[model samples]
Target: ARQLQKILKLDPKTEVFLKRVSLLLTQIAAGDFGGARRRESFEDRPPKVLLKDRPELTK
Candidate 1:
């Protein structure tokens, strides 16, 4: 989470930053950041990095 804040130039302690990160992780775990139907339009979908930090959610 700290690394994500740094990469996005966000303040790690801020609530907004934390919320956005949480949502991103939720999207990743659900296996569709923009839903399965919309994902088909994406030419390059990156793998979820959150999986490394919270592997259990993938189940």
Candidate 2:
């Protein structure tokens, strides 16, 4: 594949990807696929995190 690309001069896909992303963002801005937005309040954070202190996970 690398040799084929070197011979044929393939272009990178960034422009195509960015175009699709911009369209998706436009849809999102117009609420085409919007779900319930979560609160950004600090109180929404969990009171305790359980996974960080697992004794068996210490290396």
Candidate 3:
């Protein structure tokens, strides 16, 4: 709507903006915005200091 476009300061990308908003709502409904999910996705790699002490990297 024109009111939404005026409020959002968008030229004619209301459809695009609506699509993004829908996706955000979907993510919220699916609990994808939780911090626990982010923490669980961390890589289980060693620290940089330990990597430097390795025999392969020391060579």
Candidate 4:
């Protein structure tokens, strides 16, 4: 948090800085930064005609 304050040129004692830190902490407590997002993958095979013989392209 100190590093981020330094990077943003924020004074630690100010209201704006305190509000931002509070919001960030609240978001973190709610798992907003957790790496549990869905990933993009081929749910089903691509159209056969578009990639008829390109074996490597399937993935």
Q: Give the candidates in order of lDDT, highest first.
A: 1, 3, 4, 2
Ten residues in a row with the worst lDDT in model 4?
Answer: 34-43
Please give, for residues 1-59, the per-residue lDDT of candidate 1 as tens digits: 99886778855567686898998999889887788566675535435776667778576
Residue 53 in model 2: lDDT: 59
Model 3 has how many clashing residue pairs? 0
Model 4 alpha-carbon drift over 4 Å, by segment? 1-13, 34-59
TM-score of 1: 0.35
lDDT of 3 by residue, 7-27 (tens): 878555786878889988988
Candidate 1: where is the Cα deviation over 4 Å? 1-13, 34-59
State which candidate, 1 or 4, has the greater TM-score. Answer: 1
lDDT for 48 (candidate 1): 76
If candidate 4 were superposed on the true structure by all CA atoms, what would the RMSD be? Answer: 11.0
Model 1: residue 22 alpha-carbon error in angstroms: 0.4
Better of 2 and 3 by TM-score: 3
Candidate 2 clashes between residue pairs 3 or more apart in a chain or in different chains: none
Q: List pairs with backbone clashes in candidate 1.
A: none
Model 4, range 1-59, lDDT digits (tens) per residue? Answer: 99887767856567687898898798789877443441223334466876778777776
Residue 40, model 1: lDDT of 70
